[model samples]
Target: MTEGTIPAALDRAAEHFAGREALVDGEVRLSYAELARRVRQAARFFEGHERVAICSPNTWHWVVAGLGALYAGATLVPVNTRFTARETIDILERARVSALVITGTFLGTDRLADLGSARPGTVLRIPVEGVEEPISGVTEWDALTGLDSDFVSPAEPDGVSDILFTSGTTGRGKGAMSSHRQALSVAGAWADCGGLTEQDRYLVINPFFHSFGYKAGIVAAVLRGATMLPQRTFDVRETLRLIETEHVTVLPGAPTIHQVLLDAPERANHDLSSLRLAVTGAATVPVALVERMQTELSFDTVLTAYGLTEAVVATMSRPGDDAKLVANYTGRATAGFEVKLGEHDEVLLRGPNVMLGYLDDPDATAKAVDTDGWLHTGDVGVLNERGYLKIVDRIKDMYVCGGFNVYPAEIEQVLSRLDGVAESAVVGVPDQRLGEVGKVFVIPRTGSALSTEDVIAHCEGELANYKIPRFVDFVAELPRNLSGKVLKRVLRKENG
Candidate 1:
């Protein structure tokens, strides 16, 4: 593995794979040397910022801005693109982000303007859909080109590289901080497991904000000098088209993504023979889905992995794992991690790749990562005799919705603020397409008329799309135990 910081890795990539294609985004194509040069230019523009944030979808701009920020010795903060303006602003404020790289207007929303007074001191807007004219206050993505490129980063391998925020059971988001070495360590482990190579063309459909996309997708591709083809959003047709056209060899995302691709009616129309590797997890991976990926999708190797924002790339299935093992187990620990079942069968992980700590929350950090260096992952799992891990349940009331973690407390907190809601409880209900979707049981205030539409509408403004409840059921009261705790198990049984 390459030593030193991420910028050092990029420099190594520039020298080793100078002529090889590094990025392919829409009409843009850049070789390794060209990509490094562009990153240096963007780095010059971001040099002064302490905390830089990227709040855009998966695009060339996102890659450049993120890498550039790291190269400039800034701690990168990735904001979820699906987050509402309010949610985004809250992140920016809490993180104390000084600079922001955001989209101009995407999906009929002017994100730059949406920031309002909470906008960072410096903002660079990427025009995903060509803007008619540059915004008044924001700098255009292209504007960074004129900046001086002869810049040397002050970043160190042990320095904080990024702050990835994960929601807690308390509904508050906790930023998980990782050093440059820790970040690259996990990416290297994942790349090695998938057997990623320079010749591989990676089609990154996962959002760049999550660890799966940023660390495992982009960072892993960079480590191996693999060509990255980032898709802004997941569209089945576009995915198939890219696979056929780009000869995409590496595709890693949620099982839902591959499931949709395999089930797409138009799948046969495209020549998908180029796909060789498929890495999936974050939801239940049926044995049938694993079999179909190899048989129908022509993926030579299909693997399943398990990870969390705190300890990215903890466990992963190897290349030759059988369908049953690949689907049923998240293979043994990698990335120098020691995995064990803690109290109540909680998955406890201790490793070099574990995050340094939750940003500025020592109490929370101490609770998560014990003195013995074990990260108490609030996931219940079982380890087989062969050392394979099978995650059975969550110790915390959190669920994975389409590969993104959705904490019920966050949604419940938002619902508590609604005008007509007296009390509410949210749970994850099984969904065929997304694996799981949120369902909220509400107890309306007396004499207050609250419809399902009202509940959904209230959440739409306050929460992300995935966090919003799919089913809104009005109930007179919630079932509780002798301890006065809401019996979520009872609700799940009744709902089931």
Candidate 2:
């Protein structure tokens, strides 16, 4: 009944399952007690460190490092492991994070050693057996693994817990100042909505650096006493076997993962009946994909959630949501919040879950969170008379042709429904006379002989004259970020 803060909840978990496997990485499983002990040891090292930047995959070690920061009362800055050296430097400088914890040989660079020499804080390097050359000033992880595990969880509650950087969708990345309470609030909401239980086992495929996985995937599982099955990187076959062997019951990932799993050959042969629920979100998903999951995978309990890194999950669909309802929109934008359509149908939300402000940029923070606390989501949506929300498109991504507003999602949805098309991306391209026009990027289904003309012709019938794409670009696959959302900005730059 410790209902106050995240640190308290974590302590409750440590007591609840002292010997139960709480985190798994390959063949290695750390019991809740062992995980807690390691975190306490690391916490002792980070007692007064300015900030601890952890760069690791979704493994038991990563969780221990995060909890250590919490207990040490130091701000936790989790850098994306996929980030290049340049990107890492930007985040490190912006957050003023001096100390760093990184895995061995990330992107051909020793991140821990690099940061230790370049920055002004302690650097701890985690070595994978048989891989890396030991560096001076880099504390070996094994040294701390055997340290006394009886350190105290700090009671200081005013310190910032995490400074999570946004993915820079609009412009440059900005760190969102998150307190322990803010992060836990998001985890609590997910637990309430998802019906998380100790009996459930989670497959953590989403990157732990992102708020979606950190808050919804990792913290939610921990709060509910569920075991977290970690994977260093996603492999189709590996994921199937893990589920079959580990009996993982819960999976939270982007729509692309669900699509990939449904298409994988092992899915039919694997015993995935233990998968009681699956959650998909992070980007706009086609209704067809959701339908395919239900029919093909027999996942009766499926949910499509909506959230931003600024405040993890805002809204989600529950079990009783009409099957047709979950098929359409990304759930009713959050119960503890209110959403309104702004100019050009932009979906604006005001709620307690919205962050206080961005780390150092007050102006940008002002623009994102208004005076009344409504966070401008920049997404276009429409609420039907029945109060069901349907996303139309992103406001910035919307195009105009001679004063006619065009939502690319409408065109893309139509494009995806076409036969022989596998994946599609629609973006606005510059047009001399029209100001802006729609362009479609098509990825034909494997072994399909679909032509650009066939796709355009199909869209012509289903879409309005202006909404029809003026040009079609065929790519083998769409360029996507780590979260699996198509990087249309990249496509726009390429075409431009």
Candidate 3:
């Protein structure tokens, strides 16, 4: 019950679930006892000074590494698996990372090669199972799992325990340092808000590298003593099959996953009656998509959350709220946080969940987190009289035309509602007369005759003249990452 660490909560879960299944990946089922043992070995392995970097796939391997690293009273650095070697190298060096625990190929770059040798004052490589060993000093992840599991770790309740990396589109990635106390607080907050308990079986299909997955998938599940069903990669059919067979109680993913499942032909065949709670976050959810997901999937309980990497986890739509409110707003923004509108309508957040600071980058941290300790969220939002926060768009994504500011999300939301539009990304383009103009990149529904004018016309009726996209480009599909977030930067570079 101390400040920074979560070992106590993990212990509590172990005692509560002991022989019960804690993790399931295909044929790999690890009970709470077995998981606890491996975690102890990890703690024992890290008896020295306080942190190790974890860069692994979204399998059981990742879970073991994260838990073990935490057991050692060490903070964990979760490196993005999709980063290129150059990007990975820049983050590792910037974080001043000590040891590394990595797995198989990530975006075609070997973990060790991508991570490279640790810099001076850095401990070399530590391999996370079934992979090649280090060129110099390296420890096998499996070897630690086999070590004696009875080691008792010292409690440092309020210490920094994890460094999760967040990519800055403008520059190098920043490491958001989260304490064990802060991390577990987030898990507890999620459980309390979502009504999670031991009876719930949570299915985790999101990438563990992201804050939403890490908090909801690992930490929250442990705090609630709930079982975790993890997938290496998300496949709509496979996920539905698991939900039907495993009697999954909780389903959590980004809006994209739900959209894909809604379109999947097999979605209706599966018996998803056991799925009670469905939690979604990361990107904005279309109101129509939320309704369809509820009606089609028969989700008994549904909630949408909103937060950023710096906060680890911040806001959630309280369980039992109106479906329309849950679909449209980012909840009440949580009690631990404070939010205010900055210049240009930017939303700023300050709270315990917000990270201490970015590692080794005071300049970037200062720019993000002001002297008043408020982290500018770069998101533009409007707070209704009821206190619900509906995000309008990112600060950079908002375009100005003549004089009026145009929120791309507001425009994109309208475009997405059009009959033949599959997905859309809105950006600002330079204009001759007007200061700027809206440009829409759209993906049409298969076999539909949707044109640029059609999309522009749809927006014209739904949005203001200044807000309507002046140029609309039809593409087969929009560029997105694994999490279903449209990569606007990719579209901008391609069209700019």
Q: What is the C-alpha lDDT of each candidate?
A: 0.92, 0.75, 0.74
TM-score of each: 0.99, 0.78, 0.76
RMSD for each model, in Å, please? 1.2, 11.1, 11.1
lDDT of 3 by residue, 86-178 (tens): 556666677666666666454444656544454324332334344564455555555675677776666576778788875464423568887
Error of 2 at 437 (Å): 18
Could you give candidate 1's per-residue lDDT for residues 239-281 as a string of tens digits?
9999999999999999999999999999989999999999999
Question: Which runs of model 1 end up more than 4 angstroms from their true locations?
Answer: 1-3
Q: What TM-score does prediction 3 earn?
A: 0.76
Model 2 off-target regions past 4 Å? 1-3, 107-116, 129-131, 155-158, 167-170, 397-496
Sorted on TM-score, best first, the list reads 1, 2, 3
User: Highest lDDT: which candidate?
Assistant: 1
Worst 10 residues of 3 by lDDT: 119-128
**What would the TM-score be for candidate 1 when compared with the true structure?**
0.99
In model 2, residue pairs whose N, Cα or C atoms come closer than 3 Å (at least 3 residues apart or on different chains), thus clashing, are: none
Total clashes, candidate 1?
A: 0
TM-score of model number 2: 0.78
